[model samples]
Target: MTEIIKAESLSFDTLLEETSFTVESGSTSIVVTGKEEVDACLVRLLLGFIRPASGRLFMFDTDISTFTDRELSAVRQRIGLIYASGGLVSNLKVWENVVLPLAYSNKFSREQIEQMGLAVLNRLGYSGKLMALPGHIPLFQKRLAGLARTMLMDPDLVIYESPLTGLNYNERNQFLRIAREFHLEKPGRTSLFLSSTPEIVPLLEDARVITFTQRQSS
Candidate 1:
C-alpha cells in the first residue's frame, strides 16, 4: 500500500511524545482523542504549518522537515483541511468560498471554476444558499458548506479537525455521512480526522483509530 503519511517519535514540549503511525493511501484514520494542545500541535505538524520540536514527519515518504516553504505549499494543495469552525471567508459568499481555491490556483477558467463549485455543492445537497454568506447559515449548513469547499478540490488527503464538536447527535451523524459519501465515492482518497472526543470514532467506517495522550508531569 502507498504510504501517504507517517510520523515517528513525534514530540512537542511534552504535549506529545513518541507518537508514531502510518496512514496508507486511500485509507482512513482518526486521531481518536488527545489533549487540545496536542491535537492542535499534531494538525499543525502534519500540515507543515509548524515544525515539531523533534522527530520525523513524512508526506508520501518525503520528510516534511526537509521541505522548503514552496514545497510545503505544493504539498498542502494536495491536502484538504476543514478547521474547527468551517474556515469560510467572512466576506465571501458560500459559493465564492468554495471556488476561491480553484480560481486562485489558475488551473481553470472562471466559468469552469464556478461550474465545479456548483457541482460539488449540488452533490452535497446544497441548493439556493450558494450566494448566502456563511455567517448567515445555521451551524450544520455552515459545516456542510465547509465540506463542500473541501470536496471541490478533490484533495489527495482530507483532514477534519473536531468536525463533530457542538453538533447534536443527528447533526453529527450527518457530518459523518457526508464524510463517508466522499470516502465511498473516491475510494482512492485518504482522510484523517482529529478530535478530542472519542464518540465519533465508532461511526468512522473502516478507520484505524489512535488516541494521543499527554504524559503526566513528573
Candidate 2:
C-alpha cells in the first residue's frame, strides 16, 4: 500500500500539534480531536484549502506547503469533500445539485448532465423527489445525493468533515457501509474522516486513527 497522505510533526497555528501520520492507498483514516476549530483546521490542512504555520504535509506525494495558489487549486480537483450538512445548495433541486460541478464546468449538454446525475443518485439509493429542493428531503438522502455528486467526479481522494454529525446509529452504520463500499470500488483510492469526538472510534472498523488531545506549541 502506497502512502497517499503524509504529515510530519504537523502543527497548525497553535491549534493542533503532533500530527505525524501516513494514510496508505485504498485505506481509511480517522482524525479525532474533539475540538471544532482544530478539526476544521485539520480538514483545511488536508484539503490544501489552508496552509500550516509549521511542519509539513504531503498529498499524493506533493508538498502542500510548497504548492502555489494555482497549483493548490489544481490539486483540489483530485479531491472530494463531504460536509455534515451534505453541502448542497438550498435553492437548487436535488438533481440539479447532484451535477452542480458539471453544470459549472459546462463540459456537457444539459441532457447529458441530467442523465448522469439521475443515474448516480439512483445508484446511491436516493429515492426522493429528484426535482425537490434539499430541504424537502431526508437528511440521509441529502447526504446520499452529495455522495452521488462526489462519485460523479471520480475523485482520487475523499475528505469527510463531520459526516455523521446529525446522523443516528443506523444512519451512521448505513453511511459507513456505503462509504467503505465506494472506497473499495477504486484501487488506490483513499478516504479521510475528520471528527471532533473520540466517540466515533467505536463506530469504525479496520481504520487508522490519529488522536490529538493536547494543544502544544513550540
Off by over 4 Å in 1: none
lDDT of 1 by residue, 56-161 (tens): 9899779998998999999998998887778889999888888888878888988888788878887777654778888888777777788888888789899988
Note the Cα lDDT for every prediction shown.
0.82, 0.82
- On residues 1-218, what C-alpha lDDT tens digit does candidate 2 reach at each position? 88889998888766876668788878888988777677678777887777777788998888887888898887888888887778899999888888987987878998999788877777777778889999989888888888888888788899888877778888888788878888888888888888886777777777889877685445
The reply for model 2, stretches above 4 Å from the true place, is 105-107, 135-138, 215-218
Ten-residue segment with the worst summed lDDT in candidate 2? Answer: 209-218
Sequence-dependent TM-score of model 2? 0.87
User: Candidate 2: which pairs clash?
Assistant: 34-196
TM-scores for the candidates: 0.90, 0.87
Best by TM-score: 1
Q: What's the distance in Å from true for residue 93, model 1?
A: 2.1
Cα misplacement distance, residue 204 of candidate 2 (Å): 3.0
